[model samples]
Target: MQVSEFHLTAYSTALFSTWIFIEELGLLFDAGDGLSAGLLQKARKVKYVFVSHADRDHLAGLLQFQQLNGRADGPLIHYPADSGSFPALEAFSQRFDPHIRGEAWRGIRSGDALPIRDRITVDALRNDHITAPVEWAKSLSYRVWHKKWKLRREYLDLPGSEIKDLIAQRGRAAVSEEVATLMVGYSGDTPVEDYGRWDGAKLLIHEATFVRKEDQDRARNNRHSSLEEVLRMAAEIKIDQLVLSHFSSRYSAEEIDTTIRRYGREFRVTCPVYRLLPGQIHRDVLREEPVWSL
Candidate 1:
């Protein structure tokens, strides 16, 4: 449906911390520094966390988050299977908080899909954010799908009584087909390569770490997307809304917004676009006035 339905509360900056809480789904993307302090009581609602990578900025707040919200059936933490940092941190969290124990940690790889809540599934996709082998699970992006069963096309025109009879004769599975709608797409930290990666996603939360292409290219140690690259792709894709985050501390809010508004129009991006300004917590991002739209 709409992002407001998810009630996204988030805080993100490129080099410091990043975390997005989807209130409706009980889902948290990333666990960067200040997650507990920023969300406070709201943090208790997070039952599942999907970490994109092992970068310190992406998962620096895991200990505090788990300590406060964890119970015997504690929250589940999912991370890239090949990322070494999470295992160590998991062990430390267990030893550090013996009383508040049982934070289940799962290492997931690309193409794996996990059901986080009823009728909702989160699927992982590998991205080129980190250089590694093809099978390595070093970095990832995620897609959340909301699934429902609809009457099969062949049965849609039939009478309701007949459909019920058919269902009684056969089964619900035989009468209906499963359909999934892309509710949200998350690009944790990645360069813009696949223009259609987020196509049909209703709400896309992506990282735009650099305002300039040159600046992003200069940092060869890791990969990141610039504002223009993301907006240009947004223009070409079919996302209902876009939320830009993980902005660099180097750019002022004015600079970030100005560039977003400028390229957004230049690329003819039609979707309502919102941004999480660096170092600030955005409560209900889509409810806020959009920075760009046509």
Candidate 2:
């Protein structure tokens, strides 16, 4: 379970669990190895379960997840109504036991908000530029806000019911005064345009698929962001810390470091940045980690 400043805590029990928070509630983002009985045991605390995208890497844990969780009775499973080849609803039904198939699944578009609690709401934004059919590829960027407090936090969710609300209500998603901090933004396999128009994201968990200049066009064609684009987005959004992740297995850590430095020099932003690799660990993960500078 690799945890970083950008992503919420991830638990590697019988199943793989990675999540992000809207308020205090746990929003399960990716549940890998859904068949692992341990996966459900670990996810007992999840209030909202979201399948970020429909790609096999993103949806790999759904079967085990449905097995352990046993349907919509526990946490609400939100996903996109139509995910390229695999319509989210049909996939859920096919993957899970028939008993759990129709559990509380909500379909979402862009610009909609899903209420996690009385005080917290998750708002969704669209990434129109990315054309990948994977759920994470067509990722739904989010803004989590505390209604009473007026504080806003941003994250990324795949197209689901929660996201539909966020897309439906654009511009109205503002943070309240009571919100003390804003955390990082998740780029679940997003493209360059996904980071555009971001105003005040403190941290960015973006993907750096290719490091070499020769591979730049390939990365762009795949709708994955390059190291250069990550830096540019951070500089433009003024993120406090940027954690580049989802690297192709091809690159070594040293190679990634060289690429980051190369792009960092070009962008010249003061934000601290890091890269996330497999098997990394962090303690006391929160779905909604604070983003305010202490």
Using lDDT as the measure, which candidate wins? 1
- Tens digits of lDDT, candidate 1, 40-81: 999988989999999899999999998898876758999999
Give the TM-score (vs. native) of candidate 1: 0.96
Any runs in candidate 1 off by more than 4 Å, and if so which?
1-3
Considering summed lDDT, which 10 consecutive residues are worst modelled in model 1? 1-10
* TM-score, per-candidate, Cα-based: 0.96, 0.67
Q: Which digits, one per residue and each the tens of the lDDT, describe model 2 over residues 33-118?
A: 42234333545566676655555555565555655565545567665555663365445566556766335666565666777767
Candidate 2 global CA lDDT score: 0.54
Clashing pairs in 1: none
The residue-level lDDT of candidate 1 at 219 comes to 84
